[model samples]
Target: MVFGTHRALDSLTLEVPPGITGLVGANGAGKTTFMSIVLGLRTPTNGSVSVLGLDPLRQGAELRANVGYGPERNVFPDDMPASDFVKHLAEVRGMPRSEARSRASDALWLVGLGEERFRALGTMSTGQRQRVKLAQAIAADPSLVLLDEPTDGLDPVQRDEMLALIRQISSEYQIDVMLSSHLLEEVERICDNVVALDAGQLVAQGPLRELVGDVEGVTVELTEIDDVPGSVESVVARLTAAGLRVTREPDANRMDVLGASADLIADAVRDAVADSSARVRRIEQRRRRLEDLFEVGAS
Candidate 1:
């Protein structure tokens, strides 16, 4: 999609399957524009979008009726109580006013805001307000939810709760979720798939396991071993002479073996440790994470 003369998102084509899918990118990679298009808030310039099997450009209203959007911005009315605001939006989506009010109560309760549903949003904590936004999104019982920076401005504890809630929204509630965030670790924790964008183009998109793939090296830990005499320096020296590239992390009591098979690295670690009089405590492959793929990685 083009924004005036600048191409904000180009040649980006993909699908969101069941479960939680993470959309991660740098600041200007068009994550928000993509969400806007899917939400029918913005029309794409060149391509068409199929959100839950509906064309967003043409069937915008029908699309919005079934799709929920938890935007990053704080757009709620401070004077209004939380439940009233959520119920009003559901009413806009064609629910009867009475039904909307009931659904809004249920939604607020689901998001742990039942007690504060009647409270004015202006007086709520950031975390509580964030949950209110989430309740508003799912108030109409959307088939799909697009969450933009769902954990933004949350403290560590609140961030964890929101992330777990997002997981529940997808797993327990059976809602297909497209989570847009720059937090790679949060994505790794909850998402089944990952869509990575760079410079307005899709750089990678696939299941998390498929996207990260496997590492080319192995890591060995000696920290748990007891009564060993040798230092990491001696172990590294022994492994180096044995024709293996080893990166010694003395502070962590571990060593990374590069350019070798897992079996080979494990055997080498055992031999090197034996020679150095220390014992190998643990051995495992050094797996790559989603953040490693981005030039300017996710936060």
Candidate 2:
């Protein structure tokens, strides 16, 4: 996507599979431009765009009918109650008036605003208003929902609640979601898959687990934690001599195994400890993280 010769999205290509996928990047990373293209609000300069197997540019009306959108900014009318606000959007999405009213009420309830459905938008808190935006998007039973920065300005507690709701929407409700955010930890915590963009270009895109990959590290602890005085340092020195790198964790009794298999690393630790007849307590594989994605993409 380009605007007046400024490229907004360049050579960006990826498929969004079913389930909750996160679109993540820094500010000015062209996330909004990509969403607009998917919504048929803008055309790409050099590439085709498709959503749910339909050309978004040609089948925009049909595409939008089946795809819900919750924008990052708040745009609700101050005087309108939540129920009326959502019902109107549902009707505009081609739902029957009666069904729209009922669906709107259900959506509000789903977003945890059952008691506040009749309250004016002006009286609601920012968190409450955020839920309303989400409620309206899913009111028409869209096949997929595009959520742009859904947790923006939310307090920590509200953010957790909202993330749980998003997880529920995808898992229980079976509605596919694309949550766009810049926060890596939040995406790591919630999304099953992710699409990362940087400077108008694709950085990385894949299932979160695949990107994080299998455990490439481990943590080994000694049974002598209560007596780890000399044994721990001896094990570390031996592992260093045996070509296995280890780092002492903040907790003095444990050390992280780096650049080696869990079994081999554990063996090295045990052998080192055996020199002084020390016993092993436990060894755990460390899970992968989002930082791995950046490393792989940079490489």
Candidate 3:
């Protein structure tokens, strides 16, 4: 619903249960807009949106009470201390002053920012600031949390830690979470459900494994081809004759056989070795990742 006159979203619809759902897309893919709509920060130009059984547009206040939001962009008062900021946010959400302070400490500790609680927000590193934002969002113990690019500006170690924290929050805390990200690997690692958008349109949406399905392919590594040209041609001919879509990567000394099973790959390898002294160093059957699905679906 967080769309514009340019129509950043095209009638996108999805249902998220009490678990982590990853919303993914390339840049300008409307992921942020979709999260904004769900958070009641942006109203849809056309479709209706409900969060926790309440209309986000009309019941925004009530909806927001149970929803925690961590935006992709940086948002914090530079002069305020991390603890003060989180405590203030908790109190603003209707928690008692004493309870808010305790909850703020707990949230900061949960995000590994306990020692930095008293540090000025401006003095903290980008990763620390990001943690502060996340802590504030969850300090109120909301039922659902929306995180947009939560690992941005983090190093490899920090990214891993943040992902682990997110996983814990969803699993141990039992909070329903929806995260928007472009990193396909991260989504594949942590998300149970995925809703993919491209150029402001919903392209794919389903459970991760179901969306990927069985589009795995086999990579054949060839060797010992005295007559490279002829041997490769013959190999391709034999595979195609067997009704497989073969894509040759000449530079890599490998060919991908699509829509083929393990037995087929083994058979092709055997035939290559017998018919032409060609050696198959390796026959690897790899399941396609989410990125592969995106590329295939996009094409």
Residue 292 accuracy (lDDT) in model 2: 53
113: Cα error in model 3, Å = 1.5
Candidate 2 per-residue C-alpha lDDT over 173-288 given as tens digits, one digit per residue, 9 for 90 to 100? 99999989989899999899999888787888989988765677777777554555676777777888889878785547677778788788777777888885567788778666
Supply the TM-score for candidate 1.
0.84
After the best TM-score superposition of candidate 1, give how far the Cα of residue 264 lies from its true spot, in angstroms: 3.3
Of the candidates shown, which would achieve the greatest TM-score relative to the real structure?
3
Give per-model TM-scores.
Answer: 0.84, 0.82, 0.89
Quantify all predictions' global Cα lDDT against the true fold.
Answer: 0.85, 0.87, 0.83
Local accuracy of candidate 1 as per-residue lDDT tens digits, 1-299: 78779998888889877889999987898899888888887877876789888988789889899988888997678889999999999998788999999999999999999888999999899999889989988998889998999999999999999998899898888989998999898899889999998778887888998777578888787743456544566678777887889876446677778867888878888887777777668888887788777843433
Candidate 2 vs candidate 3: the TM-score winner is 3
lDDT of 3 by residue, 111-150 (tens): 9998889999999998998899789889998989999999
User: Per-residue error at 295 for model 1, in Å?
Assistant: 4.5
lDDT of 2: 0.87
Count backbone overlaps in model 1: 1
Error of 2 at 140 (Å): 0.7
Clashes of each: 1, 0, 0
